[model samples]
Target chain A: MYIRAAAGISPQSSFEQILADPVPVTGSRLQCMEPDYAKLIDPKMIRRMSRIIKMGVAAAIQCLEEAGERMPDAIIAGTAYGCLGDTEVFLQKMVENDEQLLTPTAFIQSTHNTVAAQIALLLKCHSYNNTFVHRGFSFENAMTDALSLLKDGQMKTVLAGGIDEITDTSHTILKRFGLYKKEPFPAGNIFQTGSKGTIAGEGASFFVLQSEASGNDYAQLTGMDTFYKPASGEEIRQHISAFLERQNINREDIDLVISGENGDMKNDAVYDMVYQTVLSGIAHIPFKHLSGEYPTASAFALWLAANILKAGKLPGGIQTKKTPVTVLIYNHYQHIYHSLYLLAAC
Target chain B: MADLKKQIIAQLNLKDLKPEDIGDDQPLFVEGLGLDSIDALELIVLLQQEYKIKLANAEEGQSVFRSVRTMAQYITDHQGKSTA
Candidate 1:
């Protein structure tokens, strides 16, 4: 499959911002620099949508617009924390109203598939719509579904995206579990700090995926693979090696590796080992500092890699000696959901 | 009636509209306020929660939610009769 077009609303304002002047984040969480949604979405619909829904719909519409598409054959969204704000509101109302007379808006918008459904509603599209809530592997699963649908001749154009949002309630709860750095630090020093926890980040990235090249595609999605709970760093190396072999590409053919190191000592150890072993000497860049660490954060990594291949330039701070032709994106969520995506310039 | 319009706006999340923008005799559903079935459900919940009025059936919603004036009249007639 190929990435026909890619657009995202991440912690950074835009890919151009990432290349020109990436802002430094200093906090426990990195929030998306959302656009004026009134311009991107209908004001009436925007009134009812929660934060994540607005971001997801906007990113998807932007991707479709970039591809010059009105309606995609399928819309698949992956979200781990789907519509958290609406969920909080719905549950709060349930308690406040003593389980009676609860308003339908919050409850209706609180579902995991609400974002995907909302996009379909806006498009008047009754095509195949699906949402994957597979925790860390959510976005990867959605992409895989899109690839399958396209490869099987089931669909021509598919809009696949990964979306997740951070809410005060979710952030507070995850903080109690020690998921974020207790002390504020510079985002640029995420790797240097060598801390116990990573910063919380959230974003929405969407891609227009097609099986055939459009001649203007961002990059060809060479291959994707995932593993769960690999026993050791050597096991991860073997997985990467096997994946590269299946793609018929040698480790030497890869010009860049987008690493998923998130500044956590425990979370980054595997990446450190991989760098020393299988992926050593590969010009690399870490993305977590730019897009905080979230379950489906690899979506942002894929979006970055695709854009980098399309632009033929690395982001401002990332120094690479060569213009990358083949890029490898490796991301894992706390070492639980490991995924590798290979991309090449079209 | 003004408070009822305020309640309707708040309950339905009609952020773009003000109470004064809605006429007292204007219909609350399609061809009037452009609300759909979902907004109708929300208006029902608004009546129960804010006015202490329980709608007897889905059919009653057609007449009761016809206009802000009708909703206010319904509330005046039924508010204390329903249990909270």
Candidate 2:
């Protein structure tokens, strides 16, 4: 299936009117500033949603609006830590209140499948409803499911995407576990060496995938693959080679490579393998520095790749010495999880 | 007043302490009260249900939710100010 329309609401300027113009990271520590969700979400519904759910619904609504449709055949979402803030609130309340007089609001909304379920409820969609929570590969797994359903010819249109939000408690937990650095890095040179932790962020990205291409089709999903274990540089190169080979694509055919190069030293080695061995001499674009590192941050990168394919012009902030992108590959690694998505203009 | 504080704490889901621990002057967010964004929204709902205070703007809520002291003062001041 081809991606018809993609919309994202991220920590950075994703859905704002000024988002077309790039805004570089001004500081090392950055967090997602949520959009005014009441515009896309009903006020009554908006009163009950967590930040993650609100972002997910708003992104889905925007994608549907952009596709000029009111309903989809399926709704799927991938979330690593679903409604962490709400979960924390509920847990805290449960423990503090001794489970006596607990409100059902936070507890009900804290489920991993709450976002997709709420979206289905809002749209009144009784179609295929699924949510994936496979750590870092959540979004990729959801995409794979959406693709398989499309291939089976069961669904004509599907909405698939990922979302995750950061909370103070989660941030502290990750920092204590060495996922992020305690000290801050300068914002201007965040992409350079001496950087420790990727700036924590949160957002949601939704894509309308259809079996048939339309005049407004953004990009065709040519190939998608994911690896579970950490691979050696040689092994990683071979995986990319085999993936492209199956799609009849050679090394020279790829115009741009969007890498998940968060400034974390431990995980940056994965990108080194791809950059040095597989995608040598190709344009490499890194988005984590801009979007900040979240579980499904790769969804935003996919959205960026689709926009690049549709606009046919690489924006300034997204450039990594690449030009005239004919084929775009987004390679991402979150801890032990790795994914590769190949997108082409239809 | 004590019952109102207990209800606010319970509704906001601040599970760490009881109404006695949350002093009237204790802050609600970062240092004193330690509530976050989600808690802020829950507090908004609490205000609507308990005091019938309707705030259309989230920015206007910062001062209105400073602490139990501030919330009690606002409820007292705006008891019959508006229909909403």
Candidate 3:
């Protein structure tokens, strides 16, 4: 259950910024504050990788370095829309050439497993490598699978992560489906967006999880579960209790609840329903203003949870009790993919 | 091939290098420009996307992409055959 190490790149700053302070985002769509590539990759190789691939590789390398392991026993990643930028480029070529000729670079790298496979290639790791592509449950699926692997003794140390990207073409395409706000609003006031869509964002995160305890364990990843389209909010509330029951904890014992509150009036009502049902008195924190909305935004939520446990620094605009112990991460996507994660301070 | 150099620089995103920095016969992979296998693939994409010259197989790209001069020669030889 111990998370040995963690690393990520996000819209705010590097994953270490929680120890200091998070810089406020300015635009509706938050773009990642990138690290210098020279520090993490070979220039010759990075020139060929798309942005999402680069981010995933960098974070994976960071995790390996932080965990002090050159080769992990396994690698697992979750992504919803993988390598969209490369896919867009390939599609553009097919459109322009009228199917006369098309290159295979973008097509090859556009697959959902490419992120995990690329990491394995870079690390020369031939262990258990897999990827999950189930929208909001993507990262949670990875976490649950990683824990299962550890529990079953298939592996000892594993590199588990989640990655997703939002490209210009994807932004436009998803906007037609009302996935992002057409008008601009101050990112800090996302809950005040009187709009139909949420801000689009992209990020990648990696965690080194181990079966035994480590010197740098951030927290114990106690439990993870996912529920798809519950019968009603009552079902969701019951499911929350069920997850806690599996972990042998009570609802009132949860010190803080991190909720995915992307501010779409219709889509956010589900989270509101959860609050009214089960998490009314719980100290809740919101992160979509900083990380924005992505299928794997829950990865950022996990990253935030680990940081809170390790650094004990909370960013502004959220309040909590004297000292927190148990944290629950609750996220849902499009009212279809719902996930729950429990973490305890080690 | 002045335009070709600029196209290569922009397409491959050599952020530190400008178009004029590349000579006509400069090698693109490993030694001359420090590009790698992925760049070779992107060069294939460059041919299909920009010049409409499609190499039928990966083996066909080795000589055609040896340098900017070779790439230009391939394009010139396949002038009328371009689909674009």
For candidate 2, what is the DockQ? 0.04
lDDT of 2 by residue, A1-346 (tens): 7999999887666533323654556644456667778688776567678888888998899899999877898999999988897899789977976774455688889999999998888888898999999888999999999999999999889999999988888988887776665665564445565556766767789999999888779999888888767556677777778888888888787888877887877678777767777788887777776677887888888887888788776654445445545565555555577788888887
lDDT string, candidate 1, A1-346, tens digits: 8999999999999888999888676888899999999989988799889999999999999999999999999999999989999999999998998998888889999999999999999999999999999999999999999999999999999999999999999999999999998976654677777678988999999999998988999999989999999998889999999999999998889999998999899999999899999998888889998999999899999999999999998985667677899999999998999999999999
In model 2 chain A, the worst 10-residue window by lDDT is: A14-23
Candidates 1 and 2 compared: the better one by lDDT is 1
Error of 1 at A328 (Å): 0.2
Candidate 3 displacement at residue B63 in angstroms:
4.6
Error of 2 at B42 (Å): 12
Best by DockQ: 1
The native-contact fraction of candidate 3 is 0.72
Off by over 4 Å in 3: A14-21, A25-27, A183-187, A193-195, A317-319, B1-84
The CAPRI class of candidate 1 is: high
Q: What is candidate 3's TM-score against the reference?
A: 0.88
Interface DockQ per candidate: 0.86, 0.04, 0.50
TM-score of chain A of each: 0.98, 0.94, 0.95
Candidate 2 Cα errors over 4 Å, as ranges: A15-21, A26-28, A317-325, B1-84
- Clashing residue pairs in candidate 2 are A11-A32, B27-B33
